[model samples]
Target: MAQKAPWKTNRRKLDITPLLVTNHCPDNIWPGISTQSGTGPGQNGFQLKPGETKNQTVSEDWQGRVWGRTNCSFNHDGTASASGQGKACLSGDCNGALNCRVGGDVPVSLAEFTLDAGDGHTYYDISLVDGYNVPMAIVLQPLENITLDDIPPNLTNPSCQGTDGLLAPQGYNPYPEYPDFLRTNTSYPLPFDQDVDENKISRWCPWDLQQTPPEKPGDGVYPYPDDNIQRPQFNPCYSACAKNNQPQDCCTGKYNSPSACKPSEYSKNVKSVCPDAYSFAFDDQTSTFIIPSGAGFEVVFCPGARSTTILSTSRAEMLQLSQQGKVDKQATIGLKRASASKLRRNAASTTFRLDRTLLTVTVVLTVVASVHVFC
Candidate 1:
């Protein structure tokens, strides 16, 4: 038997469409794009500040993902700064490069896209398959003179926010003995039942699997003032595969087939939290969404649940503001938060809530307010 060669990049010319990426988080973020197939936007990534937007063009038949990197510090040339050493962001660091050529590190919230996959349509999804770091959403631009009569309701716009924006608030630890599952031939039994409490399923990345952030000031890492919280300090939540690497957790060896591999307790919990987002590798049926081709996309980071007004606005209007140098002004004026009651209205009773102390920390962090060019 001959060995199969690796898939090579195809550099042929491709039709392009506009892509607008915005940062709605109070803090700064570095968005990363890694193309798996077809032509990319040209560069792989760049930095996006709060309330700011970047305009780029992506190939029509592109297959790739977009994710935000948090708590990063880089030199002017885009290399990792001294404080970051060889790594930049605490979550989705890509060898400390401003432009990433590969997918980000685990615990990244990804918006995956496959444009023009079939019948002049695009298939997309928000994936927590690699774990999650931030909230994200994708809205398609309305096509001129074309009605989307055939698009599915779920495909109109896929978003993961509200409780999904949080990272492991429950702090559920499946492993009584840390790193026990990492041993060869050892398997960590699934901790929760399929119908387990919504709050019991951790992201599968207990405190042991969290990525440590640089403690140095100006490194962009945000630490909670009170150390009393039981959750992990850093944001990035590593997947079970990342932490254990066992065949069962990684879907390797005999577990490579879909039948052999199933959702772990961690992924099950994630699915309950964000049904529209991918919880595991084989979570395609419910997680994926489809829309027609010829539509542009708007990817927003930290798109809070209270910001429905901004989200409801058309992509064209937002892009026009970005081009006209009025995005910042509009964001400052039209992006005000709704009432606190309204914000918490849809929250599940079992969902983790930040206490007054954490709320104060968040307020202080917001006061300290502060990327990828694919074209």
Candidate 2:
């Protein structure tokens, strides 16, 4: 029997199928401040502008929305599948529930392709749904030569380099001319315009007023008893008594007693100032690609929050071997002869005619076989 041709010996084509699954949740949603009468300036009561003080009167509320997409493809077979989902918060804390909300009917798609040897390629595609009942649009575009390795990990670093080092520590309080007592040591400067002369005069006071006096004149209508009288009334001429006063009450005899300024201390509650913003880190370990061999493949886990259409083309391929009956050793010889004949016929076809050497050999052998049969 003639040797079996390599091309007809059940040769297989290289196959590659990529499965892409993606899930996304709202990182931050710009819920334009609630337009309710009492809501603050920005969306949901959060202010967008800097230096704007938030008064207790204004309230804020936020509602979040999510969207997402997935794609799968088989390059060798030219087949593809795509799906998408989207959702919005029904109620509750926007941030906490944005990820938990279930997605609505997602659109799905499939496509197949075939080629005519080398003349041209044929392709068929179908759109599963128009918008999949989702608010956002989902689009899928065909991609060429895209592989699983081509996808890159989500970048976590900020794009721009910081120039904070170049900035000088807020130069000595912009109002250095004002005494230290007049300026608050904070990013926010007191709104009051400081009058240096006025502050200097205000700093000096009759300390004795802060002390308890021996007695108070008796008055039947007085709110308190004379024995409860605080230090003697401010006396401008009693310089000797003022100078000899205790350290706590420096009775200068010049100005009225200084009342303790409302005690100002740092707030322990971090959430008080930035109620909406938070310090957190996120870990995105999602696989950009998947392999599907037996079980069905799903490209998207979190349907809401991501685009319905993937930014790039994706594919999934599956291969199934058939098991009809056990092979017989004697059938091998007949199979070889049948395969060689098929190869010879194939070589003569227009598709394989471009290989001049192969075509010439096939033709010569065919002619020799015919002549030998006749003899």
Candidate 3:
């Protein structure tokens, strides 16, 4: 053998597929609410205006969550205020930045996931153990050439039956405000507006939280009169950890283990509103789903929200509901679209892009208004 040449084979490049994250919220219904995710392009925060849809891309192994932040403010310096009232969010405050540089503060309705998270499956769940800020749903939008039959029965459809509202085109309107006593969501049978202990008054709980800077070195609350804006409320929605220093509720100490820790009263309260989501430390059987790779997703803010398509009932049905509720239908009254959009310190600089295709129409079909039944 004169010469034997050594052979070298080329190594194949690994294919890293991009995951498209398409998100949207109820059109024009929730203007103030902002949606966000972590360990991805969402570090700088993302907003989907009412009836708006925005798409972003992430990697296969990305570990993160999708949730909503309310009552947030940021300075032009990109630094949010302290105590989660100023620059940070009063609820779901993430690392105290307009841009979430780290995981968010607790008591959030988390859409937790580790994309393509080993075992050839995506581990995901909507957890309420930290507590809930807004109702969210992560929908796996079907794709071509993908066998979705393996998708667990629980993961096939949307999650969370969010608050219901109007059917536009024919007419979009709100029902009259009930009396304060009646308006109180604490009233049972259907305390839909109340979150658990009735502290979370709908999505816009307490309406306004105390930007009243943390009480120096004290645990009690402080009120402001000299400064009109910093007024504080007696009962505000606080996370489990904030409510109690108990290690179990905080998920600290030995209670960190699933078997060691148990669901608290707060978790049960949130579970009442969002049944499908993770209500506690070990709610895997009901809250989470494991799926094979390569699936597109749609995180709808108010999942199962009633809209025009589902509301197009016969006039007779509307009339009957109206008669039953004693609602006035003949007269057309006007109510300004409520804006939960808080007046942040950096109000001018914060911006969001709206998808025109989504903004243009409410739904495929048109229906007359029977505002009572829908709104």
Best model number under lDDT: 1
What is the lDDT of every predicted structure here?
A: 0.55, 0.19, 0.40
With candidate 2 superimposed using the best TM-score fit, by how many Å does residue 374's alpha carbon deviate from the native?
81
Better of 1 and 2 by TM-score: 1
Query: Candidate 2 overall Cα lDDT vs. reference?
Result: 0.19
What TM-score fits each model? 0.63, 0.13, 0.52
Candidate 3 residue lDDT tens string, 1-375: 001111211121323323332233333211121223323543336444444555555655666666665555556664656443543565566665755655556545566666554444555666666555455556554343123322222223334432323111111111111111111111110111112222232332222222222343333434343222232331124446544567887667898887887776655544554555565556555455544544455555543221211011122322322233111333111101111121121123334332222122232322233322111
User: How far out, in Å, is residue 310 in model 2?
Assistant: 15
Q: lDDT (0-100) at residue 353 of candidate 1? A: 40
Report how far residue 323 has shifted in candidate 2, in Å: 38
1-375 in candidate 1: lDDT tens per residue? 002211222222334476778776656789999888877786688988766778888777788889998878888788665475778777788888889977898878898888766444566778887877877777765443133322222224555642222222332221232222111011211111123222332233444555552343323544454222333323466667766777887788899888999988667656655556777777775566544455567787765331122212233323332233122434423322221222233233335544321121121233221111110
Candidate maximizing TM-score: 1
Q: Candidates 2 and 3: which is better by lDDT?
A: 3
Q: Which stretches of candidate 2 lie over 4 Å from their true place?
A: 1-14, 24-128, 133-375
Q: Which of the predicted structures, 1 or 3, would earn the higher lDDT when compared with the native?
A: 1
Q: Of the pair 1 and 2, which is ahead by lDDT? A: 1
